[model samples]
Target: MIEIKDLHKSYTSGSSKLHVLKGINFNVGQGELVAIMGSSGSGKSTLLNILGILDEADTGSYNLDGVPIKNLNETIASRYRNKFLGFVYQSFNLIGYKSALDNVALPLYYQGIKHSERNDQAMSYLEKVGLASHAHHLPSELSGGQKQRVAIARALASHPKVLLADEPTGALDTKTSYEVMELIQGINDEGKTILIVTHEPDIAAMCKRNVVLKDGLIIDDVMINQQRASSYV
Candidate 1:
């Protein structure tokens, strides 16, 4: 569902330029769960930004579900991002004051969905993530894993083509991390394409494929037997 070919990106800082992605090529198909792994300065995050249309590549091509992605204006980019991409960040990214239900419903609100319909959809997703009971809780009122589940529900409420998670379990304890990964695994089993950027090997092992980046280029890509997080959770 996603294809990126020979993507190159760089950032200018004074007289020197930092090359972040160089000659990178990657593809993800429908119903696939892929993990992107890299150490610091390995360019995985840069690749994520380009894939999300949060940043434009300096050269090369990105095709999202057969549509070319390059240098889209903010308006168009925002629309496409909303329509095609869902994001889960390590920080949770939920508004401190907004209740879980409202946060989950926020994306539909942007699309001008009616309030009642959006709330219904949001509640459905919260139930999907096993967070329906906490719908009225604010981010501060929930534990790290609960907050992450609410964040995941928010991402899913849009029903986007791909869910991009950056270090999704970074803030939780081992047990909680596995619990959250189990939730993610269940979602992928239902055919949602997922691309996760993470540094943890055990977490990456839970995915069906692993792609490693080093020095701004992909050093390895391999499909493996998926490990079920439920085994540990």
Candidate 2:
């Protein structure tokens, strides 16, 4: 579902140019659950941004679901992002004033889906994430796990080809983390392509494949026996 080749990225401050991704090559197949593991300055976040089409690589190639991604104007990029990618972040990124349902419906709203249809679709996604009963609750009214669940529902509501999560379990306690992972696993089981960026070993182990990054390079990529998150949950 995704491909990258000879990816290179850099940023400049004053006269110093810091190369964040250097000659990177990577790929994620359809229905694959992959974890991107890296430490600070490893360029995993930069890689994720490129993969999400939020940023452009200085030099390289990225293809998402057979579409080339490069130098897209903001309007085209936004359209492609809505068509191809869904994101879940550590902070949840839900609007403070929007209820869980409204938050999930936001993406559909941007897609020009009518209110009743978007609400219905959002509720179904919330049900999938086990948050249907709390659909009307504000982000502030939910627990950390519940808020994350709402975020996941919001991401799924867009029906994107791939789900990209950065530090999805970073803010929660161990139990809550496992619960969230369990939910993620269930989604992957249904054939959703997922890429999770996590430093936690246990969380990485839950994914089918793990890609380790160091100093802007993929130092290791391996497929392991998937450890079921449900077992941990």
Candidate achieving the largest lDDT:
2
RMSD of 2: 0.6
Structure candidate 1, residue pairs in collision = none
Q: Write the per-residue lDDT of candidate 2 for residues 8-120, one digit (tens) a residue.
A: 99999999999999999998999999999999999999999999999999999999999999989999999999989999999999999999999999999999999999999
Q: Which pairs clash in model 2?
A: none
Alpha-carbon RMSD to native, per candidate? 0.6, 0.6
Q: Which stretches of model 1 miss by more than 4 angstroms?
A: none
lDDT (C-alpha) at residue 57 in model 2: 99
- TM per prediction: 0.99, 0.99
In candidate 2, residue 173 scores what lDDT? Answer: 99
Give the 10-residue window scoring lowest on summed lDDT in candidate 1: 65-74
lDDT of 1 by residue, 118-183 (tens): 999999999998889999998999999999999999999998999999999999999999999999
